[model samples]
Target: MSATRTFLMELHCEEIPARFLTPLWENFVHLLEDKLEAWFPTGDSANYRKNAIDNSTGLYSPRKLAWRLVGLPAVQPDQTETQVGPPQRMCVGEDGKPTIQGLKFAEKWGMDFSAVRFEQPAGKKEPCAVVTLTKQGRPTVDLLAEALPGLIAGLHVPKAMRWGNSEFEFVRPIRNILCLFGDQVVPITVDGVTATNTTWGHRLYHREHPAPVVIATPGVYESALETAGVAVSVEARRTRIAQQLETLAAEVKGRVVADAELLDTLAEIVEFPKIVRGDFPADFLELPKEVLVTSLREHQKSFCIEGPDGALLPCFLTAANRTDDPAGFVKAGNEWVLKARLYDARFFFAEDRKHPLSDRLEKLMALTFQRELGSYHDKTGRVVALVKHFASRMSDDTDHIDRALEAARMAKCDLRTLMVGEFPELQGIMGGEYLRHEGAHEEVWMAVKEHYRPVGADDAIPGTPLGCLLSLCDKLDTVAGCFAVGLIPSGSKDPLALRRAGQGIVRILWERGWAFPPADLIAAALRVVGAKATKPTAETNEALMDFFRDRVAYQLELAGYAGSVRRSALAAGWEDLVDLKARCEALSAFAEDTRFASLAQSAKRIGNILKDEAPSTDFDDSLLAQPVEKVLAACLMKLELAPDQASLLHALANLAGPLEAFFNAVMVKCEDPALRAARLSLLHRLRQAFLRVADFSLWQ
Candidate 1:
């Protein structure tokens, strides 16, 4: 028996990018756990490994990544090694003595001939000569010393660089390595840095305490860092920053504009957080709310504060990695920098308002959408045409159709603006603001602004009918044009974000309950793209439809639909996404009924029996010989064609009893070919009815 101990390891380096910290820490922890589990496997060793992983904590900041594991075994469990040799016939002679081949086999395994025994391995019928040996467990400290160097060197980050004269590549230069097993240091070296039990504190806050802090044990690692003005735990730092932001915002009778992403980035970039509130000129509020927030968040990494009325308060909060700022130097510097950015934004806004949004349309001729797809000017023409095609199908109001067309024409004009040149994230948003400032129609301006909604998985779709119409046209044109030019997305190589664009299209259609078939939409988009399409129309149409089907399946899975239900519904028909969703929900709800399994199995059996036969519903009822066959035929005829999906599912479930009885009592393949054909046609009719709701043959 061996006692359990705690293990800790830390890598101190130059500041890593804020986005790379979380992923690097996660991979590092996962790799360590996998290695430890593989090295220690046995009765008590399993429990110790489980405890270590369950109690582990990953510490990550821009400057450090560390892990602390508790209850790890001090030594690996003993293992057994087995070697198989020549077959029994080769190893034994007629008198049951060792043959010359057997002696060499035993010598190869470093065992005496007497130690070899005849045994049959599992799953093998013949006996073979085998030898078994026991290996003693090694100390955990020794294993760590041998594994740590390679593990540290193999950590992956998006972009890595080499520093100084060393050939080692890392996200940042390694300054120190700290490792400990219980109270003893683990002697390991990574690149040129050697492991120790000492770590430094916050670079700025702990300048007065320049000496390194010695960690006596894994149990006191976090507390030791805390005493030296470093908060080692990421969650603790985030909570502290959040509380400081709220407290400061409350002091000025305002609330901090909540941005979870910014909070996370700030947490990763700081060791200790101190919040400072700074003010800009109230005239900056004349700019749109989005511009103010974007400038503060993107340019300065600061948080905006809003008044109780939900309007901008002209104040912002910035988090500094320090204990305090008694003279307000940090606050002054942040305020000055933010004011300069706001001044530039105001200038751009004034200049952009000089012309109507429609006047910028000609500027798009210089911007290429894609080399094969012509310029943004050409794309706008396609979009306007697509909007007309889709709008006519969806609505009859001429005013609505004209508004969508107008929005399509001016959507890409903002890309040429100075404000958008500085902040590319505000492309669609700035266009809408300029339109509104020039007294454009409310519907037109809003439609332009929201055309790029649902940019990612968790984002919202366009809020208005016209907005959704415009968004669909824009996204569809891009996807269809790219597919036309043979730029389809494959594997992970979607440089144009075709997958995201496709998903946005599906989401907008499904969420809005629009009943357009995917093929029809693809055809319309291709027609708008006209002669630019090089691929055959039928081929491109098929590939685009399959792509849309995949997006629909992905979205359904995210919404918690089962694979069987999705496949069954999709196989029946996926022309209308709204109808597909309804069928899926109906099938899912019906799955809870007591008769579901029998009905599904019956449908599967019918499909299998009629696999290659194409039988029509016009079967001769007079040829039905058995009573069971007649009863099934009558039940099929009596099935009420229900208008709603749930009623249809219930109607399908009613055939289970008759189907079971028919299969049990009747044999379809008879001596008379005509009789067999009639029975097959009857079964085909039943399968067709089931196909209306779902292809139950695909049911698990």
Candidate 2:
């Protein structure tokens, strides 16, 4: 038995973009693990696996990407290699003696002619000549040295750059490559840089100490970097920044406005994080809270501070890469940059407010939403029509319908505002703010602002009824237009984000319990889109509905429904998303009953028997001659007539016994054609009842 070892590799490069660091490191780890696992299989037992790699640790900063694999075997186990050669017929002579081909094949594998055997490989029509040999495994260090260079080069990033005279490209120029196995260097090389035991520290913070940090072993890498003033671990830097931000915010009697995404980005942007608290003129707080927060985060990578009541406090915190700001230079620089950004924001706001959101409607005609789908102005018209169509169905009040229509007309107007032009994330938010400032109706403004709700899976749905209706109209119009223009999402390509739009519609309908049929909504939206829609009406309607069905299943899955349960519910019909969700929930709970498995199997049996046979559900009760069939019919009648027991689960439960008995005694395929058709119809009714809840046949 061989002892385990630790392997470490670090690639230090020019500053990587903050967004690319984490994903790049993750890709590197995935590639390394996949290759290593193949080279060293865990085998049958946990003890055998103990010799394979254990924990894998990946860390990244703007300037470095590092990975550590622990508990790796010093050498891979010897493997059995099988080499397949030419067909046995080609290798054999007429007399069954060794032919030239046979001899050459044996020699190629360093085996005698006697060692060659004939065996058919999978998917082959003829048996082929094969030779098996035991190959000795090489030392882990040598294997790594040969494999790491290519592995590093294979990493995929959003963008790559070439430097110096070399044709090699990476996210940035490679400055250093440090590779160590246990206490020894593995001798890997990537690009033009060769691996060594030495790596640089924080480029600016360690300038005074100015000597390369020499790591003697994989175990000392983290501590050694810490001594050199570099926080190599991303989590460590994130924690330190978070704690410092809280301490700084506490000093001002405010809390940091939490933004997990910005926090993650800032964590990767710096190596050794030093918090700098800065303030801008209080007048900046008068800007909409979203504008101030977005400017602070987007422009400066800073966190805004909020008072106890959640009002913006005109203060922000930034994470600077240094040990200390003894002269307060970092703080002053951050404050100056923030002030400049705020001044620009204020100017944009003042300019945008000069004309109300309504006045900007004409400007949208110039902004193309999609080349074929027309302009923002065109989309607004479609959305307004959609809102009118949906709102009428959703509400009978004239005021509610009018307010929703107004919101749809003004939702995209902010795309022309200078503030929104400067900050695209504030499009919907700016529209609402401008409307409110103009003294528009509160419902209309709120609807415009919240129409883009539930932007991500975890985001909140629109809070008000009018907002929900308007959101559905807006999202439905976008999905319908894009899908009509042949922009449907396939595989990983969804340039129009039709998937997200579809999901937003699903989440709003399911969460808000709206009962509008998705097909009707698509039809209405297509009608509003008019000639811009090129796809055939029926074909476009089905594609959009199928897209929505998938979104519904996805949302239900996210809500913790099982795959079979979701499939079953969706299999029945997803025309009404809210009803589909309710069915899923009921089926999920009912699946736990002790009789569920047998009943499900029986339901599946009923489907199999009735497949391709659609008998009229209106069967003659007099035709149910068998006592067992009579019992089943009676149970179904009691269920249908008993209005008090109308719940789907209860109906399913009551049929379980009668269905089991009916299948046991009734012969669905009988000698008598009329009686057979009657029995089939009876089974069909039972299947229909099952489908009312779910297509139980889809259950595993």
TM-score of 1: 0.96
> Best by TM-score, which number?
1
Lowest summed lDDT across 10 adjacent residues in model 1 is found at 635-644
The true-versus-predicted C-alpha distance at residue 495 of model 2, in Å, is 0.9
The CA lDDT of each predicted structure is 0.88, 0.85
Clashing pairs in 1: none
Residues 480-558, candidate 1: write the lDDT tens digits: 9999988999998999999999999999999999988888899899998889888888889889989998998887887
lDDT per residue for candidate 2 within 60-137, as digits (tens), equals: 788899988777778777888788999999999889998999999999988899999999999789999999998787
